[model samples]
Target: MPISRDDVLHVARLARLALTEDEVERLTHELADIVEAVGIVAELDLEGVPPTSHPRGLVNVMDDDEPRPPLPLEDVLANAPDHEGNLFRVPAWRQ
Candidate 1:
C-alpha cells in the first residue's frame, strides 16, 4: 500500500501539525515504505502460534514482604531542612 500526498496532508491536519511542502513530500515516501513493510509482515502464516504479551516469561524477583522496626522520629527528621513537630514542613500549593 502506497501513501499519497493527500493522505499525508490529512494525517498532518488531524495531528494539528504545520508541515512544509518538503516535509509533506518526505513523509509521503516514508509512510508508503512503512505501509509496504507492514503489508509484507501481514502475509506471514502463524496459525499455530499462541498469543502472548511477552515472548519470554516474566517472574517477580522482589524479596518477600516482612515487617520491620520503624525508624526513630529524631533520626527520620535529622536531614530535614524544615520540620514541624515530627513531620517535614512544606509550602502550601495554590490553584
Candidate 2:
C-alpha cells in the first residue's frame, strides 16, 4: 500500500509536527518506499527459520558478585570538600 499525503499529514498532526507542503510531499514518497521494501521482505519464504533478536550469539562476560569489606570512612570522605557527621553536605535547593 502506497503512503498518501493525507496519511503523512494525519501522522504529523498526531506527532504535533508542523510540516510544509514540500515536506509532506517528500515524506509521502519516502514512507511509501519504506513500506514497499518491508513488503518485499514479508514475501520471503522462511517457514523453518527461528526468530532471533540478534544476528550473533551473545553471553554476559561479568564475574559472579561477591561480598567484600567496606572502605574506611576517612578514605571515603577524603575527596569531599564539605561533610557533616558521616554524610556529604550539599547546598539546600529550596528556601
Candidate 3:
C-alpha cells in the first residue's frame, strides 16, 4: 500500500494546492506510511467484533425536563444595542 509521488500530486491538484518540491516529497512519504499502517490494521483477526463509534459505553445523562419561569422582558432587552418594542432593530439592507 505504498503511495506514489504522482498520486500525492494528483490529490493536491484536485484540492487546488500548489505544493513545493520539499512539501510534495514530505507528504508522499507521510501518506505512504499512513497507508502502510492502515494495511497492517486491515490484516487483523476479529471474527465477531461488533463495530462501535466509541470505545466506551455512552449513557444519556440529561436532567429531567421541567418548566421554569420566564425572565422579565425588560431584563432580556437590557443588553440589546438596539430594540424596537419587543424585537431587535437593525439597519435596513434592501429598499
Candidate 4:
C-alpha cells in the first residue's frame, strides 16, 4: 500500500525535518497516486523478455594510446604566468 499522512510525518521526524500539517497531507495523497500507478505497471505481462540497462546497444569511442615526443623546455615555459628557473611558480594555497 501507499504511504499515509502519519507515515510521512514519522519519516520527516526521523530525517530531522520539520513539516507543517498541510505538507504531510499533500505528500500522502501524492505518494498514494504514484504507488497506484506503479501497481498497474507491475501487473503487466513481460515474460521471456531480457532486462536491458539501455534501449540500444552502446560502444566506447576511444583511440589506441601511443608514445609521443616532448615539447621544448623554452616553449613550455613561455606559457607560464610566473616561473622560477625551469619550474612554474604558483600562489601559496595550503595553510
Candidate 5:
C-alpha cells in the first residue's frame, strides 16, 4: 500500500500545512519509500528475544552527595554585573 501524491496532499491538508505542488510530489515518493522500508523491519523474527528496557545498558555515574564549606559572601558577589545587598540587582518589572 504505497501512498500516492494525492495521499500526501490529503495529509498536508489534515496537518494544516501549505505545501507547493513540488513539495507534494517530493513527499509522496519519499514518505511512500519510508513506509515501504519500515515494512521490511516487520519481517524480523524476534519472538524469543527478551524485550530490552533500554537499548544501551543503563548506569548511574554520580558522585555521592555531600555538603562542602560555603564560599565567602564577598567572593560570590564579586563578579556580579549588578548587586544590591546580598541579591543580584535586576531591572524592575513593575512601577
Candidate 6:
C-alpha cells in the first residue's frame, strides 16, 4: 500500500514530532517502501512450514555458581561523599 503525505504527518503528530516539509516528503516515500516490502513477505507460501521464534535451536551456556568472599565494609564505603554507617546518604525528598 502506498503511504500518503497526510499519513506521514498524522504519524509524526502522534509521535509528538515536528517534521520539516523535506522530512515529511522523505518519510512518506520511505514508509511506502517499507509497507510494500512487508506486503511482499506476507505473500510468501508457508502452508507446511512450522512457526518458529528462531531459525536454529538456542542453548544458554552458564558458568557454575561458586561462593565468594564479600568486600570489606570500609572498602565498599570508601567512595561515598556522604554516608550514614554503611549506607550512602542522600537529600530527603518532599512530597
TM-score of 5: 0.43
Off by over 4 Å in 3: 10-18, 59-95
* Cα deviation of 23, candidate 1, in Å: 0.3
Model 2: lDDT of residue 27: 95
What local lDDT does model 6 show for residue 29? 92
Clashing residue pairs found in predicted model 6: none
**Window of ten residues with lowest summed lDDT in model 2:** 52-61
Judged by whole-model lDDT over C-alpha atoms, candidate 5 comes out at 0.90
- Model 2: runs farther than 4 Å from truth? 13-17, 59-95
- Residue-by-residue lDDT tens digits, candidate 3, 56-90: 87767799899899999999999999998999898
Clash count, candidate 1:
0
What lDDT would each prediction earn against the true structure? 0.89, 0.91, 0.91, 0.85, 0.90, 0.90
Worst 10 residues of 1 by lDDT: 52-61
Writing each residue's lDDT as its tens digit, candidate 6 over 1-95 gives 78999999999999989999999999999999988887887777999988788668666758789988999999999999989998999988755
- Kindly indicate the candidate among 4 and 6 with the higher lDDT: 6
List per-candidate RMSD values in Å.
9.5, 9.8, 8.9, 11.0, 10.0, 8.0
Give a tens-digit lDDT track for model 2, residues 1-95: 98888899999999989999899989999999998988887788999988888778666668879988999999999999999879999999777
Once superposed on the true structure, which residue ranges of model 6 sit more than 4 Å away at CA? Answer: 44-95
Q: Model 4: per-residue lDDT, tens digit, 28-94?
A: 8988888888878777689987778876766686888987889989999998999999999987877
Clashes of each: 0, 0, 0, 0, 0, 0
lDDT of 5 by residue, 1-95 (tens): 78988889888999989999889988998999899988897788988988778869677769989999999999999999999899999988777
The TM-score between candidate 6 and the true structure equals: 0.44
Worst 10 residues of 3 by lDDT: 52-61
